[model samples]
Target chain A: MSFDGLWPYIYIAIAGWLATDLWRWAGVVAGNRIDERSEVLNWVRAVATALVAAVIAKLIVFPTGTLEASPLWLRLGAVAFGGLCFFIGGRFRQIAGIAAAIAFLAAGLALLGV
Target chain B: MTAPPESQSQSHWFLLGMRGIFSLPAIILMLSFVGFAAFTAEAKVPVEQVMFMTGMVWALPAKVILVGSMLSGAHIATAFLAVTLSSVRMMPMVAALIPEIRDRRTPTWLLLIVSHFVAITAWVFAMEKVRDVPRGGRVAFFAGFGVTLTLTNIVLVGLVYGAVSEFPPIVSGCLFFLTPVYFLTSIWISARHRVIYWALGIGLALGTIFAVVAPEYDILLAGVVGGTAAWWGERALRRREAAR
Candidate 1:
């Protein structure tokens, strides 16, 4: 591959590594120094939690690839069903919720013959 | 708080951690990685590249953001920023998790290395279980769990890459949904603060609106605006409660 072709991987290596690893290194340095209950840390936690929530929201609302083929209503219904199963499954809710969502999507697709 | 009992042996604790990862949590993790594998395949990313991303990045959200951004012909710097922003959550996770397994005697280098494995799966597990492990055994336990997860993800991604061609379209489509569903549910189960609830509600609303308004920067926009709103709302509520 040309250097142009290889640029993405290089970017992935440097940028990707820094993005995730910086936090890890910082956490190590700050291990016990920063109290978990501190205002700054709590704010950081809120932002981080919000970021992940935004990611999930973006995926559901503005998905790419095959997921884009399904109608918005179907996707929302799937998530709702999955969240319900998550609450009901008790112990292994992650798997249960995901399974329910996929099953709901499959059944919906089949019914519509999509 | 009282000290936990001394571990039977570090090796025994390590083994316990290794065994502990074989349960539902690990299964969910494996399935999610499998979904990622299928996603990369559909995106036409090379298998070797996918493996490299998994090993190095290790965070699914960052990986997804990187792959999606690059494929859309985004500049390298822009892609990097998106990935980094998406991954900022790991800072708090690593910060929170390391203390549970750390003691003064624990080497800084070791903590740094172990921190690499502190993804959501390992972090949640370590936070809940490490308290029961002896202080000296905590590192070993986390190492065992983290290492197993890393290796398993690497292997699972490779297998799924090779196998994606055989799966029917619906199956692969469903697999692609697994990662997002897993993340949302994990967040739901782990949410302990009212701020988290506000953030989720606001993020969903803003993210949905922004996706149509500005597709390229929706995640970042929603995160900053929704997160800040939630933080302020939480503080206001706390102040009112204290005044009462």
Candidate 2:
């Protein structure tokens, strides 16, 4: 790709990395003194968790790539199925299983010509 | 430093490797990255560049945004906006992980470079396993795992890139589904804060509706509306609970 074309990616990578690295650096510097389970940290956890959730929700509800072309109902249903797998598998396994299940389900649906 | 009694009890390198290997989220992500790299290559991005990005930039969503935008002929500004928004989620993650690793001897600038590899899977494993390991070892362990993951992602991306022509559209579609599914599944199963949950639901609903009307600011609008709503709703609910 041309240098002009590559600028956005480079800028984004550096900026995004710096913005995020600030927190990790801040965490390391600040973490030395505070109790990890402090209310402030807990709130941080909650907010971070929520933002991720929001992003995920955005992707599911309004995807851009190949996912955008899949049937909305199918995508939603696969998510639900994945959620079920997550719950059944408990915290650790479920976290991984849910994504796999959705992928498998979506692939299966596509194979059936749906 | 005294071994945290917990970590001292579980010194299974093999087990840790296995756990890292078997983790479903990591596998799915690796697969998706492979698929993404493949798709990017098909669109004419060079493999060497993709590998460099994976190793150096090390941010998957941003990579996807960068590649996808180039392919779609979207403006640089638009691609940057989307990527910046997506990467905003990293703020909370860094906040969560930062305190866990802080100490007198550790270098802040050094950790900053390393934090690029601190993706969702790293966060998940770190959140779960870091508490058990020694503070000094936590970074080392995470670095090891992250390197392994990055390598895995590259190979997967390379393989998929080679076979991109053979993969049918639907199969490709299914590969993309892994991320949203992973996100939604993780959220439903793991999130516990009632207000945050409400905020996420509200944010998503608002974002979706707003996206239909105006795609550009949907993420910002959703975040503001959802975050504010969750904050206020949480306070109000807590007050009601106290009164009861």
Candidate 3:
């Protein structure tokens, strides 16, 4: 909130900006050499998706802050609920899945008296 | 992926890209931001920094990692390294995506500039829809969606940041869940190969184990190992099928 406070924000901004964008820059550099349909390209796609999957899994399994308040089973339950709705919900599958995940999380939380 | 038509005007492509804001993914992504705002407020981080991170960093995962590390009292350098490793997945993704949308004449600088906006949501959105967009217009269309999504969420987070204190912890938790769930389902649905399933499963299992072993590097290690294993595993399966 003051002049002294501004340093952390500046450091965070720099770290956040560079940390995220570094990969984008790297992707463009690496992208130029990759044959679009090659096995290597498929590997790249696999790696990206897998990494994101890892991140999601980590979050769900060992969350920080408020999400850490809920039990891991309850968290996975919500995701499973969402996944189920996603498959069967037809045209608005994403909406159903997301809405279901939230609703399930809320219900689980309520049941635990949180 | 069809025949390339004559280039449309830049504005046309831009608006077409902006139109994605109303789509299911974008709506869910926005809700994800609403959760971030709420989550950060509860953790007592500066609202201005969170907003700055939303616009400047522009990736929810990176922002979350930054705040999560700070809350846990991590060294700044460790947080930076963790965030960088997390974003490394962008390499294969942007590589896979940019070639699909750019023409030979598309400028490198423009591609570099706009590529900053090509996070997971925008990448999936563009990959699904850009097949029909003419080659000349694909960049604009991608930019329209990516840039607009960033700006929209930045503003959305800013607006919600101040009001998040009133929200219950459960509400914020559920709101935050939207982004990851959206990412999970959309990526699984849009995956180009069956081998991706292998990667997803391995990544999840290994990620949980690695979380306790080396929390800072868990995502990077699990992803690389899992993905490489999937590729090799699928290849062996194919060879066995051929032999049979």
lDDT per model vs. reference: 0.76, 0.63, 0.80
Model 1, range B41-126, lDDT digits (tens) per residue? Answer: 87788887888888888987788888887688787778778887666667666765666687778888888888888776777567
Best prediction by DockQ: 3
What proportion of true contacts does candidate 2 retain?
Answer: 0.31
lDDT of 3 at A25: 86
lDDT of 2 by residue, B61-135 (tens): 667766676567666566656666656656667766777754446576756655766776677666666666677
Give me the chain B TM-score of candidate 2. 0.77
| Chain A alone, TM-score per model | 0.72, 0.62, 0.85
Model 2 scores a TM of 0.76
- After superposition on all CA atoms, what RMSD does each candidate show versus the true structure? 4.0, 4.7, 3.2
The candidate maximizing TM-score is 3
Q: Which candidate has the highest lDDT of all?
A: 3
Query: How do these models rank on lDDT, best leading?
Result: 3, 1, 2
Name the weakest run of 10 consecutive residues (lDDT summed) in model 1 chain B. Answer: B1-10
Q: For model 2, what is the C-alpha lDDT against the true structure?
A: 0.63
Candidate 1, clashing residue pairs?
Answer: none
The TM-scores that each candidate's chain B achieves against the reference are: 0.76, 0.77, 0.86
Ten contiguous residues with the weakest lDDT in model 3 chain B = B1-10
In model 1, where do residues sit more than 4 Å from their true spots?
A1-12, A30-32, A88-96, B1-9, B42-45, B68-79, B99-101, B127-137, B210-221
Off by over 4 Å in 2: A1-35, A85-104, A111-114, B1-19, B72-82, B103-105, B132-136, B187-203, B235-244
Worst 10 residues of 3 chain A by lDDT: A1-10
